[model samples]
Target: MSAVIRLLLRRLGISVIVLIGVSMLIFAIARVIPGDPARIALGPNAKAEQIASLRAQMHLDESLPVQYGHFLADLSRGDLGISLYTNRPVTKDIAQFLPATLELVFCAGIIMIMLGLPLGILAARYRGRWPDHLIRVLSLVTVSAPGFVWAVILMLLFAFYLPLFPIAGRLNDSFDIARVTGFLTIDTLLAGDFAAFTDALHHLVLPAIALSLSGIGQAARLTRANMVETYNKPYIEMAQAYGFFPSRIARIYAFKPSLIPSLTIIGLDFAAMLGNAFLVEAVFAWPGLSRYGVAVILRKDLNAIMGTVLIIAITFLIVNIIVDLLIAFLNPRIRHSARGSA
Candidate 1:
């Protein structure tokens, strides 16, 4: 087999192993936590027989190994079991909630790329100028503050004071656009509801920006550092000596090379938004999987918790795989070296 194919296969294998490990760890942790899922579901007022019956129905009475076996078997068949709190299939609950989180994360990722990359390139092009210093300071400030803090600050400034954007939620209650794909923006567009789409976009702005601030800072910093290093490279110097404009050199010669190194970390930052967005979601009262995740954990709903964790893990793995493939494609050295070895 070609080295690239072998490398991809290896990465796939590692992703599977990592997912399995995450599942096992989460399962073990959920079980070890000091609370009976059945009892929690039943509540303090429920009788012993009720709790016992629920336990029996849930197969919580089984031995840990047997329970784990059943869990794996059910997972193999795309069953995530029933949620104790929601009293619905875990997968169903995830389906209902996950899209909101995905929408928010996707928006934030766009903001990160749009704002971060250009700033980085600009900063690198300017080097030690005032604009570069200003970008560096702003990035530092954003990176130092937690996301929730930004959420609050942004909400106060834009939502409360100026009132430019809606303070909370995915959409205003008046808009009854049909849910085609569960993504409000796309669904609204598909429905030809430009008004609803505009409202949805307006509502998404603050929260997406809040959730993306840290990622933007990190992306900018990483991109700037890498591009600065690239500016010193022989090829960049050659391009400059050949009478190419500094702007052209920075945009073409320096930017693309620097981007390859920055892409992996940028991918990771985007994946991390799934977790870090919880506080932002809570602040905005955005109905997403992060809110559902918090509810299940608080209620000690084992199946829901496990399902949420597993989905997040799967997403992280998928992002990493995409990043790896992109890196392999962008960096010819990897492919050439692999071919040489083969």
Candidate 2:
């Protein structure tokens, strides 16, 4: 228990340090981008005096270190400055949009685990049989392309020709679901609108599938490869000799051991989905943070860009921490080893 607490504290402290690096890196990148943000925000007809004023307001005339000092000071107060794109505070803009992306990514992560693991297990169980071959081929095909390409393909097939799923958006406009959580499905459920919840889910399916396809494929391949290797180990051969059910051995003995390493890659893929969600969101018209981030970056909204990227960085670190805790939990030796080293 103490080891777990220590691990959490250590990870949190490391996350903070990483976030500071991320802030400085993003700040430098934003600063170096060609073109004055003030000119871009004000547009072509802006007077020189107006541009100077805006730059001053942005602290652009100050030295980089001093500008960064003020930026950090504002950040400490939870002030992300104003978004030139939305004319709102960046934090408010993120609050409005972040949950949608999180919901979408969460749904995709679920798909990856639920679908990928089983397929992998089945493939490993079958070895060189047709099921294994089929799954391998399918995974290869799915992973060959990026999420947005899948989004376009799936949208065209199901949304246009077959019309099984709606083409885009989080919910039908006819359903007046409250924006309680910014996650339409949860919000609708909270509102006791089963009909709206179903509609929201209906809208979520295509985009989630689009975002998850690559991850699903990657997970399936990794799980199958690892489990296959696990099967050849001495314990697996002993389990086979002991008359243990092949199914039981495969599920319990093989899968559990292989899962530790798989968890790290899977977690990374899950985090990667946040970045990948941008194109899929654009395709689906999903009004997520990804869309807002793209908008701010194009407009050179430095404050908004930094805020969005920082939020994403924090989310990424949080996911990694969760994966670490999960790994530590699953294998108690991690805790023991930490306590040992400490």
Q: Which has the greatest lDDT? A: 2
TM-scores of the candidates in the order shown: 0.96, 0.97
Stretches of candidate 2 off by over 4 Å are 338-342
Question: What are the clash counts of all predictions, listed in order?
Answer: 0, 0
Residue pairs clashing in model 1 are: none
lDDT scores of the candidates, listed in order: 0.92, 0.94
lDDT of 2: 0.94
Model 1 error, position 233 (Å): 1.6
lDDT of each residue in 1-342, candidate 2, tens digit only:
778888899999999999999999999999898988999999999999999999999999999999999999999899999998888999999999999999999999999999999898888989899999999999999999999999999999999999999999988889887788898888998999999999989999999999999999999999999999999999999999999999998798899888888999999999999999999999999989988998889988999999999999999999999999999888868867755554
lDDT of 1 at 36: 89
Give the RMSD in angstroms, all C-alphas superposed, for model 1: 1.7
